[model samples]
Target chain A: MLLLVLELAGTAVFAASGALAAVRARLDVFGVVVLGMTTALGGGVIRDVLLDVSPPTTLRDWRYLLVPAITSLAVFWYHPQVARLRRAVLLADAAGLGLFTTAGTTTALALGAPVYTACLIGMTTGIGGGALRDVLLREIPMVLRKEIYALAALAGAAVVALGDRLQLPAGPVSVVGSALVITIRVLALWRRWHAPVARGLDG
Target chain B: MLLLVLELAGTAVFAASGALAAVRARLDVFGVVVLGMTTALGGGVIRDVLLDVSPPTTLRDWRYLLVPAITSLAVFWYHPQVARLRRAVLLADAAGLGLFTTAGTTTALALGAPVYTACLIGMTTGIGGGALRDVLLREIPMVLRKEIYALAALAGAAVVALGDRLQLPAGPVSVVGSALVITIRVLALWRRWHAPVARGLDG
Candidate 1:
């Protein structure tokens, strides 16, 4: 039940980001909706696909689809107000990133995936939506270009994998893992931290 | 047997395209290999995921992985020669598109998917790799911006779907469908056919 709620919330936040991007790009209403849905669902879908989950849980449940659709439409109608709340959105996005990464890692571990694969899936789950949205909008993915995003997710996933190997309880381990991700992301954002670019490329 | 051969050939062609794109983008060696693998396997992975095929055939088979890895390395070493064969590469890409689209539609149909779903999967299978490649290269997907690429794939997929509905033999149906896609793509390239853009967007 908690996981479901977190997933829905994450979907809404990601959808909002996608909708905002679409509006900025001057996409039509249909394009806005499509991009929103893709952004919200892309990560989970990628995770599920890697884990061999058919049809994906998001596709199986109408609520998952509805959350993004409604959220996108809401953003479309009231974007100015929504954009004004950018700080809140960023914070919520960090929370979403944490929740998705931990959840993806946990799910992969449950499914008997190797530790390394699970960690990769977890990072992918956290960053895949934003990557897809950027791709659709013809921009370099923020995670790829500059950000502590993917590394944070990977770190959190590693914590989960470590906990699993140590035979720790899942519930507390998940909480700690998620907190780690959220902290790292929020701090990175606050400090404006960036991943280094390829050296000597400009020369 | 034939399908396997087609799939391998398609993977190689897509890998070449991706490696060439990565070289043009000035990605490092690691990025070149990763992009090549992603392009070669992406479409098939998407199709398999949608159809509930666990582990995706590309991931399960060593040959599928090996082909792209080798192809990318070859392209990385001899990019100038590869670039010089642009015409040949384009033609091969068209053939790959045809084979993948028809094969994807057939696979979905075999899994008892609805006709519309099968057609979409088929089109995705044909175009998903190139879209991923473009996304990674920070360019708008060629299919979305201009060209008859996706439509040609969709039309071919529809042919296969129609053949299935009519209870035609899979062999001849696939051949005809693939031929339709190849013909349309080749003609589109020769005649410079393009999909219409959104009207009044420039203004």
Candidate 2:
């Protein structure tokens, strides 16, 4: 039940982020929905594919599709209001990232992926959608740039894998792993922490 | 045997294209190789996942991984010469497109996807990598813009699906469908055919 709620909430938050990006790009209505849907579901789809799970869970489920569509429409209609709530959106996005990281790790582990593979897959699931969204918008993915985003996902995924290895309860493991990610991300953002840039590259 | 050959050849060609894009983007060696591998294998991975085939064929096969890596290295060293051979690269890419399109459509059909779904997935397989490469480089994907690129893949996929519906021999059907795509794409390029742009948008 908690997992279902987290899944839906993450989808909604990511969809909003994508829709906002589309608005900033000044794309047409079709593009807005495309970006939103992709951002919300792209990671899960990729994870499912890597795990060799057919048809992808997102493709099979109607609710997963509908939420993103509605979120896109909402963003298209009232982007100004959405834009004004940037801080709240960022918090929601952080929560979504944490939830998704744990989800990805657990799913991979359930499918018998090794600990290392599970951690990587988990990070991919958390970051894939946003990376795709940025790419579509003709921007270098923010995750690949200054912020400590992908690392946070990676760290959370590692925690999940570790918990599983230690034979911890699934529910507690998930909550703790996700909380670790959320705390790190929120602190990074508050402290204006940044990832190290490549040595020769101009900022 | 033919499928394996086609897959490797297509991966090499797509990897070259990705390496070229990385050169244009002035990315470092790591980025160049990463983009090349992604461009070479991204489509097939997506297709396999949608068909519920786990562990993506590319991930399972070392040769599939190796070909892209080698191709990327070759491009990194001989990019200037490769850039000079633009026409040759285009021809190779066209062939890769046809092969990937047929491969995607047929696989989906074999897995029992409906005709429309097969066609769409085939087109996705044909174009997904290039789209991903462009996205990573922060450029609008050529497939989504001008030229009859994706349409050609769709046409080929449609042909294959129709052929299957008619109970045609798989070998001949695949050959004919792929030939159709190559012919159409080559003709479109020669004639400078362009997909219509949005009426009021700035070109």
Pairs that collide in candidate 1 are none
lDDT of 2 at A121: 90
Question: Looking at model 2 chain A, which ten-residue stretch has the lowest summed lDDT?
Answer: A25-34
Residue-level lDDT tens digits of model 2 in B1-203: 77778768989999999998898889988888999999999999878768867778888999999999999999999999999998888877888788889999999889877676677678778888888888777687766453578768878998999999999977778888888988998898889865432232242
- Would you list the clashing residue pairs of candidate 2? A52-B54, A54-B52
Whole-model Cα lDDT of every candidate shown, in order: 0.84, 0.83
Per-residue lDDT of candidate 2, residues A135-195 (tens digit): 7777888787747788888889989998999999777788888888888888998999977
Error of 2 at B117 (Å): 7.3
TM-scores for candidates 1 onward, in order: 0.62, 0.62
Model 2 DockQ reads: 0.17
Error of 1 at B2 (Å): 1.9
For lDDT, the strongest prediction is: 1
